[model samples]
Target: MMHSFGELVTKFTSYFNVRHFPMAPSTLYDPCEYFLGLGGKRIRPVMCLMGNELFDKITPDAYHVANAIELFHNFTLIHDDIMDKAPLRRGMQTVHTKFDEPTALLSGDVMMIQAYEYINKVRTNTIHRILTLFNKTAAQVCEGQQLDMDFEKKETVDLDDYIEMIGLKTSVLMAASLQLGAILGGAGDSNAKHLYEFGLNLGIAFQVQDDYLDAFGDPEKFGKQVGGDIVANKKTFLLIHALDVATGAQKEELQNLLKQNEDDKVEKVLAIYRSCGVDEWARSLKEKYVTVAFQHLEDIAVLSVRKKPLKELTSFLVQRDF
Candidate 1:
């Protein structure tokens, strides 16, 4: 029988906690352990297991792929935090901040290698296909990150460009996670492709919601500074839209806000965003992507009951305030 989303998460977490890592080098492995132990939602791995279970039982191969996905996700987070100079993650110190930068960087690199080690454990006829998808997704994630960094320096970034960057950097791995799970579970190429599309759309919607929460979410629930994106001049959807639509004094005010480092900077930028209706636009766009994601999930050739867990997971994701 298929498991509920919560059960799947619990099972994955338990399996992950007991998995052995090398003990010889305490510094390198300790940070990896600490970072993993910080306990994210484990959405990618859970989705991978769900994708596998859609066609067949949750096999050891599914666990291996899920482990790889989780490892890679954390690896990216470690490096990303370093690049962003972020101090906290999951309400704890970031790897780079908790440890030193050099150790954190090396730890992240080792984690990537270890991800492949799990990938190699798939023991399937489609291992090469899985690796191909995995490698391509990995490369696109790097490209997306580079594009994001480049955007911070550019004066103007098109909305389409921002979407593409997030899609590559954020969505493709989610898509690949589903595809990888589906392939290992003996799903057909068509079903696997549809699942990938479902993940891609869902990932985009999640990122859009992230952009929304950065500005409007309650600080107690948001787990970080509410206007961090604004404070850092990150080219979020709201900021980008505000830039595109604001004119004359409004535009000048927005540009000036970007240059300032005052305590009221977040509030000033948000006031400008509200005037331009960027928040409403972001909500509508987020709903649009969620609708498209459900459509892709519907296109999958499975019983409606088999689709329930994914539906519930999607609902939980799109509706979350944090």
Candidate 2:
């Protein structure tokens, strides 16, 4: 019987919420435990399960890989919070903020090692391929994060460059997660590649939606401060597109706004975005990527009935108000 997304999410979470570490040194393990306790949607790991189920029955290897993907994803979040120096995650103190930086770093390190331990539990036949893909994707994630940092320093970032950075930072892991599950489910290489493409485009679309929400969403529903990205001058698709399409006084004003951290900054910038039709453009850009993602999903040689959950997931990712 095919498992729905909710069924798999319940299955995965039950398995994940376990005694994952020894209780000797409270420093490292405590931070790890705290961060994991800050629950998320667990999208990547569940996507792996969905990938596996799409082609065939979920395998023993898929669970192991799904666990690994969840661990690895959390590992990145721990480090990312530290690197971003974010004080809060899900309204709780971050690992680095609650604990020390050194401890947080080590917590991230141990979590990554534990992820590999889970990876090693997969079947012997698929172990090598899984490791290769996971490793490559991990490296790419680091590289993408570096590019995100580097982009913050540069004066002007091209649209293509920003897309490339997000593709590496946010898209690769999702793609790899799905592909890894596909391989474990006995899919051929071509089908695996199609699933990866589906994931990649969907990931990009997800990021676009997230970026849009940061500017346009209600603070109450969004669960984060509106205009956080704008106040920080982070290069996002909307800001980048606004710069591209804006002209004359609007262009000059936009350039000036980027240099300051003023209170009215978000309002002024969003006004410019609206003037340049950036909000509309962002919606369509997200739709463009979503369209491509769905096409790739359609190409995966599976029965249509098996694809319902992914399509629902894709819709939810792109259409969320929060």
Candidate 3:
């Protein structure tokens, strides 16, 4: 019997909510607890468990790795919020905003260490392989972050470069999370690799959808300011496509919009995006990646029933309106 996605998420949440954290040095650890307590979709960690269960029953080692992945993800969010100067996360104050910056930084560091501690608990002969992949993925994420910051300063960014940046910064961890669980569940190397591709494609599609939603989604459902990306001059896929296709006065208007710090900037930039067919292009691209992701899932050499939860999860992620 296989668990549904909701069942798996509930099981993982119950287990994760009760995990122990250090009591000493209240400042460092308290923020960790607070940040983790602020709930998220828990997609990455749940996908780890799904990867394991796809091959065999969910094991204790799978739980350990899932916890590690969640810890590491939260750690990244803490530091990223600081860098972005973001005030809110999941509708609450960010760690750096609620606490001091130094505390938030140290808390993030401790979370990384704790993540490794959890990884060390995995009683598998393939530990070295898993650690290597984890380290490489971490480094790539940092590289991706740097590239993203660099892009903010540049006047023009190519579409391929943007995709690569997102792949490294966002997709790699998602891919590694699934691959690590598959390896721990005794899946063969080829199937594990296939799972990684499935995650990678799905992650790319998710990010593309995110870019779309930031401009077109309803403000109430979006949970953040719609057009926040445009105001910040962030080089999302839609903006990049708009720049590439817009001409003459339209391009000039976009350039001026990017330079402005006004309230109506989002509406104006969205008008340009629509006129340039950027919205349609982004939607088509998002669907393309989703199709590729489903194809990879189909190639995984598992029974169709075994793939149901993951397929449903992927569908939920890419088709979400918020």
The local distance difference test score of each candidate is 0.90, 0.91, 0.90
TM-score of 1: 0.96
Instruction: Please report, as a residue range, the 10-residue window in candidate 2 with the lowest summed lDDT.
Output: 19-28
- Model 1 residue runs over 4 Å out of place are none
Local error of candidate 3 at residue 105 (angstroms)? 1.0
Q: Least lDDT summed over 10 consecutive residues: which range in candidate 1?
A: 15-24
In TM-score terms, candidate 3 sits at 0.97
For all predicted structures, in order, the TM-scores are 0.96, 0.97, 0.97
> Candidate 1: what lDDT?
0.90
Residue-wise C-alpha lDDT for candidate 2, range 120-235, written one tens digit per residue: 99865888999999999999999999999999888878999999999999999999988998988889988999999999999999999999999999899998899999998889
lDDT per residue as tens, model 1, 196-279 = 999998999988899999999999998788998888888888888899999789999999988888999999888988989988
Best of the two (1, 2) by TM-score: 2
Q: List the residue pairs that clash in candidate 1.
A: none
Clashing residue pairs in candidate 3 (N, C-alpha, C atoms within 3 angstroms): none
